[model samples]
Target: MRSASAADFNATRFIARLRSRGLTWVLAIAVVLLQYPLWLGEGGWLRVREGAQKIDIQLALNQRLEVRNASLLAEINDLKQGRDAIEERARNDLGMVAPDEWFVRVVPAQSVQSGKTNE
Candidate 1:
């Protein structure tokens, strides 16, 4: 028979004690309970990752809004400071005519743009 070495003897005694005291099950439950807060808890890595993704989405939305705001601000400043901008909007959007200009709008019977030539 092969003699048990000190390492093997210690390991054997440790397993026996664990089996007798049911420490294996207690340790397993303790480890799982401790891991709960790290993986599935509110302040855990999963929640942190989700929060980071939300922050990234919000930051991108804010950047796009900022660009749109800058464009609106430029348009507002142009309308405030320039007569040409105001005149262009009035002429195109409201169909405003000058006092000396003739407003001649010819009504088309057949819409010439939709593959129909009024020839």
Candidate 2:
């Protein structure tokens, strides 16, 4: 018959403890693997943050476009409602003349003489 010693008993107890802790070790490894994708992996937190910034930029661009559209709409309404607005733009841009209006031409004084003459 074999004799059981204290060392053998302790070794058996240690093996049992290790077996009990195996599930904890496996769970810890699983947590680390899962966190890789949530925090550091591709299509993870970093990518989500970048996407949020792009959305913010697009929203700002949309707001600017909306303001410009509103201003253009107001200008269009003014042009349609008021003949003065059309006439003002035409006179400023085209240099138009009415039938009874006289045109004035002012020449520079330097073109009047070739010599250095004081006014």
Best by TM-score: 1
lDDT of 2 at 73: 98
Off by over 4 Å in 1: 1-21, 102-119
Candidate 1 residue 118 Cα shift, in angstroms, is 17
Query: By how many angstroms RMSD does model 1 differ from the true structure?
Result: 6.9
TM-score of 2: 0.60
Cα deviation at 56, candidate 1, in Å, is 1.4
Clashes of each: 0, 0
User: Residue-wise lDDT of candidate 1 within 15-93, one digit each (tens)?
Assistant: 9997977977888899999999999998999999999999999999999999999999999999999999999999988
Q: Candidate 1 overall Cα lDDT vs. reference?
A: 0.90
Residue 40, model 1, lDDT: 94
For residues 1-119, what per-residue lDDT tens digits would candidate 2 score against the true structure?
Answer: 44578778889999999987997899999999999999888889999999999999999999999999999999899899999989888877887876888868666678667655433
Query: Candidate 1: worst 10 consecutive residues by lDDT?
Result: 110-119
